[model samples]
Target: MTWFREGEELDDEDIVSKVDYTTSKLLIRKASLSDVGTYTCKFESEDGHKVEAEFVLYIYKGPSFHDTTIYHEFLEGADGVVLCMVTGQPAVDVQWLKDKEPIPSTHRSQLTIRSVVRADYGEYVCTAKNKIAESSATFMLHVFEPPEVFISGDQHSVNVGERVAVSCNVTGYPQPDLHWLNKQNGQELDMAGRIHVLDGLLEIKDVIPADGGLYSCMAVSTSGNASRDVSIHTQPGPPHYLTVTPGPTSVLFTLKTFPINGGTPIKSFVLQWRKNAIEKWEETIVAASDVLAITDLRPYTKYTVRMAALNNVGRGQFSIENTVRTEGKREPDSPAISTDQAKVEGNSFSVPLEQSDNGGSPLLHLNVKYKEEAEKSEWHKMQLPSDAKSVNLKDLTFGSDYHLEVEAVNSNGSSIPATFNFTVPEQPVSSRMTKGTVAGIVMLIFLVVFLAVDATCCYRNRCGLLMAVAGKLSRWKDPGLKKVEEGEGTTNGDVTLKAISKPRRSIQQSGVQTISKEAGHLTEVTCDKAPLTKNEKLHPTTDA
Candidate 1:
């Protein structure tokens, strides 16, 4: 077998090839793009048949980068782009590299930075690779920015004839320039002689009323300019014509403030006072007015007072001192007293009193006195604390009238006595007597009802009860009496009589017989002789 390049025969040592004559197969190794061309193949059999064909061969290579290096420039916050174009047969894969490290694969030819910063200024590489070969491109990015400026201090005040210095601060890539200006007149301040400007500081010597206006410190940079204003003030003079007035527990001071504020308005007034001239002074801040009231002071005290005026710069000198005395302690007013009903039990009573109006001073004690109205007894006194509103009186006589007086006392003096009149009520009747009377009446009524019921029972039963009683009485009297038969007889001297039984049944045939009392004789009676019963006859046995 043989190979050709550009229509020239190639030697076996210069190319690698494999051929199989039985299978009619051919294979090539280590092929490159230069091997892309047309080739011819011929085969002949022993039977005298032959075949001939020509075909074109194409070789695929890996990606090739169009540019080896790239450059890009942008501000800190601007966007940046870098191109990594490549060409090769059979599509290749592309990726980005940052600082010699492989980045994520995007299959894109361009690398874009959405917002660039200082951290983004570094080496970047774009790589394209395929199965066979790989290529890369490099780029360097630069980011730049302008300067930023700011001022430091603001609104400072200095006293009159005092030296003052104001400073400013700046920050940026490039250092900024700083200067001082008079904001009121829109004029630049001279930095020579008495006024000097060094670095970021501005110094002013011998401040006066003319220099009390607004002054500004300005900072200039490539980016922009920034400024801050400072307000200066010259102190005013002290207040004058101080007057003091004393109250019960406080003091009032009136003063005349300076008409000209000495280049600055008075912000406030200070009033100083003390209990004694040698003690530390207590101060009270007051508005820009003529009068000041200081409270929470001790009563009945003497104090020394002074005044001063204050502005934005500083406090002025104090005025002349004056002495005044507070009002003295006063006594309490008369106390009003009220009383509840007197509770009287037997010979004891309790009276409750309520008192009000302790005046300005706190009450220390109270005095209670009482006397009997009827007998004009000596007054009894009791002492109690000021907080006590009720008093209990013991061992008092019952059914008696009392006159009570209460007085309140404080540190200063006692008030007018408050008087009240109450009576120790009479002893009430005992409940035992009423209960006994009710019991007696109930017993009497019960006895009467018993008697009436007994009578009713007797009437309902007729005279049987009485008759039985009589029979019993008779039996008691004649215990020998016995029941007689029909033929029974009693023997006497020729006076024989038959005894009868059940006299009530034989009363129809029975007769009553009588013997003459003058003759003193006895008689025998029978049923045949007397046919009428004694109960049937209305007439008496003896002739009337």
Candidate 2:
């Protein structure tokens, strides 16, 4: 026995079959669209007899519409048909409903309208039904005339750097796409950071003079497209490139006019200048000229100049301020020199001079004269370049003072001579030798004074005439015999007293004193001991 579908033998790949001599069973696995057909089973006996049985297997699938929704627009009195194709098994039936309600003649898959009317514009639903399931789709039907777009609002005027918005009202059966375009250049305006478009409104943030033109708001649709132009006017901007050229007693100004003109022709230009911050401005009117000249200005004075353009609206913003100073008079003043900069070297010196003010004139030359102070020699003069500020004098005698004089000469005349006096320094060896001689003399004088003072002190202390006299008296009084005493005591001699000798303390040895002693005994004498007469017996005194 074998099973077949569509004239082809079915095996385990298509259907499973279990067979015996009298009964058979067929099983279908994983049924699909192609499996929904007639299936047959045939049996052949050993005597060549055949018998067959036929079976129809149907697959059921849910119904679904071709599209979820549709959008269509048609003019009045136009014929149109909307299709609602459904895909499913067992032949699904589609019905068209208007506003969720079924239409009387909408039995077929397509809804046909002989003539579209204004009242027929509403939501239409297409529902597909079958035994297994049903699905539906919706569509918006618009029955009206073609799009008629109009922009509302008149011409607009806005200042530069301001914000503006323009509206474009549109009338049509279906909503249309809005776009903003530059009618002058035919370029579409994009929704950028500075410009935006929402619904029918076009907005511009910080509008400039260049943005002033014919702007078109276009409404685009399937039926057609419409556009309208709006005139936009922008006010004039500030003037540019204002410059001033100074003269001796006047000034000339040149500038460019404001290009936009604020939607009006420029009538004139206003020029203003002031001496300084403390002065009021002086204004002048010029008849639409790019250049103007102002005279009778103070010489060598700084002034601030500015200009603005005048139009039908008003005066635009002034150009950036420019500062200029008029030239001074022709005759120059005397050049001032710094006398402290007169420098002297070994046998050379340099005189540096600077002109404090040019005094409306350029220098032609400089004359420098120098002469020795003690000599009867004539002054020597030298000519210097106009730009030279200092003159170097060389080969001069060392240690000799010289007087220098400098005068500046211009086209007008020479200035008063500037005088300076300077002395050249001595040679290095000569200066050092002089200093050494003075130092040596001072040291020798100090040594002589030191020796004299030391000799005087030694004579007064021990080796002078007073000590000689004392020694002679001691010798004559006791020529052969001498008295002796021990410890702290007094001694008497049997002799005439010539000069009494007192023990003296030596400053160099603190409290130690020197005393004369007899030949045979040693004695310690204190400064407070009393004198004894000759021929008296000597006695030793002891500390109690």
Candidate 3:
């Protein structure tokens, strides 16, 4: 090596050159500016010096790729996006692939897919590469969609004897294939037995109640499989009714004919009548011929009837029962009686007897009677006041008991007597003195008249005897003392003022008691009369 000095050179020691070669060591070190120099020297040996070339060094960084992200969950038929950003001193290229195939270029087909679906489900790999570095990441895709189905008629309710149609409808993309299966079993059902398919619809014609059940429609596709379930419901049949010809006796009914559910043609019927009110049943079997007559049926009764239909699917739901009732009967009754006041006075009563017909004849006879004391009285014969069937009795005593008896007489016979009794109250009276004084006066006048007549008769008879004696003495005596003429002093009874004959006395006053066999027993009747005043005429005892 040669040295080139830039600073001041020293003396002989600094400029000294090596004249001896060492055989034991070699010196090698990192180059520095201190080692840089240019120097010239003469060789001691011939043809041994050689020359070498100079060199320089330079450095730079490269690109890198990391931080991959997919902003959506992997799902079938759904689009997904993946991002893997690259960072480096140099830029890199970016691209996308599905199933290891680059996407095609078209109006709908692009590397960035829209509305991705099940076919796109797979491992999605993303890669980045540059002059310096390269990287890759992967994501899984899942595809799925549930199934949908429907029925043709969509009917859930149906009556017996009514025809029905059932069908299943299914729809899906990718051309889904459909089939039918029973809910009770996983086995597939045959297309036979009233079951058929049109297009994609599975149909069951004339579906009966037995045909009602849970059915499943299964749809299969390249992507997945789906199924739907449906329920079939039915209603009870129409009503069965029973009617009675003759009604019941007491609001209880007995049907004449058997109950009939009109849904089916009747062969024979069982007549069952139940009291829905009481839950009691009376049952009988009747044929079509005997349906007209129902013996011993009671009127006005309530009943319920039921009918059932039988077939291979077993007896269907019973028909709705009907309730009926019987009619009512008539009753027998009797007549009634009432009365009105005929005549009434103070403390006295006069009643007109009127007889009204009540389930009987008109010519009814009534017996009239009076009694001071009821125990001693007998019926009296008094003519009725009128010719009419009704009668009135007058002059009844006050404060006296009266009884009346009416006998209902018909052409056939007389009925028991109907009796009525009543009493009339007496009128109150005052003045006790006049009743006795009048009796005394009546007695005194009778006594005084009788004595005067007796005195006159005695004087006439004595005078006659004196005159006879004078006559006889005068005839005997010489000196005859002749009687004075008696005619001169005699009083003429006929010429005198007409003397009133003593009035005939009442039998009550005469002290005579008489009785008649035919006479009704005398009843002591007390009449309350007005007090006898001076001008009032006394009641005559006997007509003279």
Q: Name the best candidate (by lDDT).
A: 2
lDDT of 3 by residue, 1-544 (tens): 3322333322334423222233311122443334444433222335676653332221222434456454334444566555555554345444456688654441111135567665665666555555767555565655444345666554344444455445666655555778877664455666666755556555556655545556677888765687776655443222235333333332122333333232233344344566665767665544544333333445566656554433222334544566666444322111111235535466445554544442112233333444454676666655332124443555666678777654544332444554556676665554333868778988889877765665454344322333345445644552211221223433222222221133334222322211111122221111113344553346643333
Compose the digit string of candidate 2's lDDT tens values, residues 1-544: 8888777886664334333435577755576777788888898999999999999888888887765449877786799788887788878888888977789878776888888877888899888888889888888888865566677675787777789898788766566777888775687887665766777788878977556667888778876778787877775566776667776566777764355575556778788899888889999888875347666678888889887777654667787888999886544445556667767777888866677544434567887898989857788999988678778999997778888887777655777777778888767875557877989989999988876775564466544344446556764674443333222334453322222244222332222223444454433333323444453335432321
- Assess candidate 2 and give its TM-score to the true structure: 0.31
TM-score of each: 0.31, 0.31, 0.28
- Candidate 3: minimum summed lDDT over ten consecutive residues — where? 330-339
Going through the candidates in order, what is the number of backbone clashes in each? Answer: 0, 0, 18
Candidate 3: misplaced stretches above 4 Å? 1-74, 77-91, 97-142, 156-179, 182-188, 195-200, 220-226, 231-305, 308-544
**Model 2 misplacement above 4 A:** 1-152, 159-162, 182-187, 206-211, 246-252, 256-268, 285-301, 310-314, 326-544
Q: What value does the lDDT take at residue 183 in candidate 3?
A: 61
Which candidate, 2 or 3, has the higher TM-score? 2
- Give the local distance difference test score of model 1: 0.66
Higher-scoring candidate on lDDT, 1 or 2: 2
lDDT of 2 at 1: 88
lDDT of 1 at 138: 80
Query: What overall lDDT goes with each candidate model?
Result: 0.66, 0.70, 0.45
